[model samples]
Target: MTNRSTAIPQLSWSDVCGRRLDRHGLSAPVRDGTPADAVAAMCGAHAQVLSAAEVSIGLRVAGATRADVADALWRERSLVKTFGPRGTVHLLPTRELPLWTGALSAIPPSSTTMPADARLTPDQTDEVIAAVAAALADAELTIDELSTEVVARTSPWAADPVVPAFGGRWPRWRQAMHLAAHRGALCFGPNRGRKVTYTSPRRWLPGLQPAPAADALAGLVRRYLHAYGPATPQQFAQWLSAPRRWATELFDSLASELEEVEVDGSPAWVRAGDTEPPPTPPHGVQLLPYFDAYTVGCHPRNRLFPGPAAQRALAGGQAGNFPVLLIDGTVAGVWHQRRSRRSLDVTVEPLTPLTVAERRELDDRVERLGQILEEKPQLTIGTVLVGGHA
Candidate 1:
């Protein structure tokens, strides 16, 4: 731990970016040769959009393909897909699920978000959570099947409509499924045809158990600082989908293990002894997929994706709309891709002109993307809409 009287270092935007890139395993190719290493490096890969998660991991791990990621999840059991930080689907290393589950469960659920007509009583919620764990203990079941079991074990409340979505009603008790995942009780299994399935983590990973909530939360905060440090309490709260006051309290509790730092004039915290100047910026051009962890992990959106870059890279302030062109750890442009039987055409629109070297590096990264998808490359450079929508 750093001494209390240690002078805090002020980091430039470039320095912050350099350290983040290195920590995320993007400064150079990941030499570990395992998908779990890349996922673990970023804490976990954002997996709300499945294909985007595949591309995000493939870009960091050398020689990794989309199929390789799938194999690790389904066949190898080295990775598990579950609702993680911020209540979003994420691909987490199987061995680390306990820590994530315990930390996430520590956050009390918000009653404001629950619909009055479909809200479950506190006792009912507990019943549904237990039912979900039991129903999935030794079997893989689709949401429909699991819902049936939950209703049978709990009450009719589990099947009642909570709200309207996607031209259909969402049941109130479905919230328990999310809770079960956060409790380390359940995780996603392979798809059956077009339907998704859920299974018990205990069945999939024998002897797996969650650590104490306080210890797990501290560990999670330390890991977050390592990957996206110099972060404010609000930023940490946003990442975890918890209240700012809750996050601030958690941050204060860990002060003994953390040190203050300045980022672009804003005061933030990082792990103790991590106040050293960041390394020189890495040189390269890369395409980051939609919902990429690197893009989502960095905060203070105005700086990392400023003005036009933000408008193009993000949709209505959301960061997962389009694939982004990253130049020296900053968002410089946006891109989209279309695939044909014989070739893949990637359209790129740079907010500003790139240097000759940057353009060459861009091409190299494009070729690498092609290899990961098992498709031939065809480059098209121009302005394109977010998500490639017309």
Candidate 2:
């Protein structure tokens, strides 16, 4: 049973949004913060579309640019790109890798079953991972190079091209790539021309090791609550794409540190010290790019994507497929951007009528976006004809 009490604190949707946005650096952005600061605030930036991830972090830091983010990843080494939440490419703070690696490795495996011919058996998985770790320990290697090493180190079955991906088959050994990542055996290295490379975290972070699992997961839970609280274990599970039962038990293990609260009459939680209500709901316009941490992980989806937003901005009830327009903490519209040379063509379709001031704010925000992206932005206030993930 949960450590819930009758005296649970009550919060409205606005209260929840206000506090959450504040913690995410959305309500009051940080002018002095670095990309790492912004990245840690959002847990990590989803980077399937690296440029979009740059924008997501850049906008949260005043005067930050894509150059700054690139420097952090490649030069300063403050950020590490790896398979993160939901096993997607994400830019996580390097210093936090121990927490990330430990927690990720400890997660219960996904419930979805892969096809027999496409998946690795338990022994093969371990063998492939060991081969991967050995191959990347001292040098960076591309997936092809790693595959070659795996095939050499293991049996030819490790090289069997049986898994369908992106219209072609990937070698069976590639299936263990993420597993190797979670086990702290691999992470992204600098790109060679257009090809990606992988290196051992040991080589990259030197003397790096995952934190103890229980400690790391507890810290991750606390951090998640700090940013996205008045949230439930189910919501946390969705964010990490972790097993629901595992998430529930993890939260249960932290009952002493968490304070149960009531949000919009529904049960939720927050860090024990964060029981007080936040200042106020944020005002003005927010243009969030695809797969933004806020859009992807926020709870009470119906409220964030109220009415038309649910139909327009979300793909099958999942957010992050479309760039969103948030006004006063709720999704007010959808937007799209197309890059042209050094300029961006921005299209916005507002589901609600904007006041003259809101329109002006939007124009300023678009200009601000151009500043962050080092582009010239042209805004169209009418229809966004493009579909999601455009």
Candidate 3:
């Protein structure tokens, strides 16, 4: 989406970092907002590890703790856990679930999840989805419980062990689990003991369904642009794990509402009326958890993950594999944490030397992290040998 009629306004990389850090509540993270508001600001929190997702949201708000994020998900019912972007578990603002479901519904289905030989037929997939909805309408159920309910509701073939899992075979109907979540048939419920549970969304928000596709997609584009603008369609596509061509066409359709601009020479687009960069560049040290949305969603990877960060902060150029130490809105190092009964031990591997002031900032970040996690924190600056933070 370009307005090539006149000279395109140019934005510097530093300017982009400054604005993004400010919008993400990281530049001056001492702000006021609920956990759900923080989640909305970041589009959503990648929650494959629920604890990391809680910390991701908690860090964005002033004085917000993991408990606050948990309350929003379980008590207040203001945020929901479901299969979000890329069909990964995420904590999305409950109020925006309809928009998420709508846009996702409009997306063409991606590659199949299971092997071709073991995959369910189209009709069987539909039957499983319907059974899932019907079974979850009133009570929350674990995967095993839901499997039993689904098998009873559908054909016996639905329970056949076809899709291989953690050494064992998963029921054929289980292949449609993410599909059920994406279609708003169900969402994560409070854990029942050590097992996870799923329940229908209708229980909390009656009559909720996907919004009309066209309007919902437009709204989603605007929301995404608001959170991560001055981005390319390819970057947006990569973030959503959607096909590049679909993202390109979506950007083309919203041309009137977007403005193309030059960023360190490369072309990018922002919401039409928003072209000015933040007055101040990003500064200070902040620690980000695994799968933090900012690290996973930002574009122009070379700049966000530069030099040593390219090797330390990312896994083969893919962001979010390692928890990172962000200095001035860019990845600067990698970190690891170990929690005990009384305190959390944190080790940081800095790619760049830290100044006296930066060291103080790092200590402050560790203190705040301890507060959010409800543990005393001990910071160690040395080699971080973790192969996986998750």
Candidate 4:
């Protein structure tokens, strides 16, 4: 059991949003330096869609190009791409891999919920995890190659089909891949042609040292609060893909370290001494790429993404399918882009009519996006399809 705090501070919704923008590196972009710096600021940028991850980081760092993000990951070795919170791929700073891995490993595996036929026995699962780590300890290998190695090291059981997915059977061993990544034993390497590859973080990231599990969990929670504070334990749990009880227990353990705050009359938590006034709302409009951290980090969908914006921007409550149009921090519409030869064409559809100024600002933002991609942009203002509606 842990001690709890009672003196909670009250803060407005706008204040929370403003502070989030500042903490998320949206108010003032981090100076162009390393992709690690940008990833660190955002806690970790969603990378399930690699291209979107590039754009997400590019939007927050001045003069950062997609190539720059790639260089940081593949060439400079400053960033490590791996499965993170919620079992989703994320790009994390190489130096912080230990913290992420330590915290992630602390979460008990949920494989027991899988149908018996689809689940690996506990001993089999452990063997598969160790085999994966050993195989990728020094070299990058594609899924097929890694699977072959696992079969050789463990058994045919390691390659047996666990369940059906994407119109085909997913092998039992496949689950171990996500497990390996979460434990920090494996991470994505640059694509080998059309096939993605994986490598060992221990071999790829030199001089890595993971903090103790408890310390790492505490640090991760604090970082989450800093980037997306005034948040509830349920929201935190949702973000981490952890059991509600586990999240609540972790929250209780840190009660003494966190300061209670009210978000729109609801209780939330922030880091102790994080009492600075919220900054002013950011000006102009922004076209946030798919799975942009800001869009995904702030929760309680009803609030951050309210009304028709929800129906249009999200598909079955799942984000990342379409890029979002951010007008003064809140999602206002959805957008898409296409490229042909030299010029890029962009289409934006706002839920409500925009003033001349807002339209102009939107255009400017699109132009900036073009600069980031190093291409000329052609703009088309129109309705964007969302939730099967136009």
Clashing pairs in 1: none
Backbone clash numbers for all candidates listed: 0, 0, 0, 0
Question: Which segments of model 3 are wrong by more than 4 Å?
Answer: none
Each prediction's TM-score against the native? 0.95, 0.96, 0.97, 0.94
lDDT of 3 by residue, 1-390 (tens): 787776888999888888888888888764768888888889999999887897798788999989888889888999999999988899999898888888877777777667786888889988999999999999999988999999999999998899888989988888888888877898998899999999997775688898888888889888888888889898888988888999999999999988899998999998886888898878989899999998999888889999878877777778888999999988899898999897899999999899999999999999989999989999999999888543
Error of 3 at 224 (Å): 1.3
What is the overall TM-score of model 2 with all chains considered together? Answer: 0.96
Residues 165-209 of candidate 4 have per-residue lDDT tens digits of: 788876788877777887767888878999999988876576555
lDDT of each: 0.84, 0.88, 0.88, 0.81
The sequence of per-residue lDDT tens digits that candidate 2 reaches over residues 1-390 is: 245664778888888888878878888679889999999998999998998898899879988888999999989999988899989999999889889999998998886466766778889999988998889999889888888988999999998888778989898888888878888888999999999999987765888889999999999998899888989999999999988999999998888888888888898988875877777766768899999999998988999999989999999889899999988888999998989889899998999999999999899889978887889999998898988873
lDDT for model 1, please. Answer: 0.84
- Please give the lDDT score for candidate 2: 0.88
Pairs that clash in candidate 2: none
The true-versus-predicted C-alpha distance at residue 171 of model 1, in Å, is 2.3
lDDT accuracy of residue 29 in candidate 3: 63
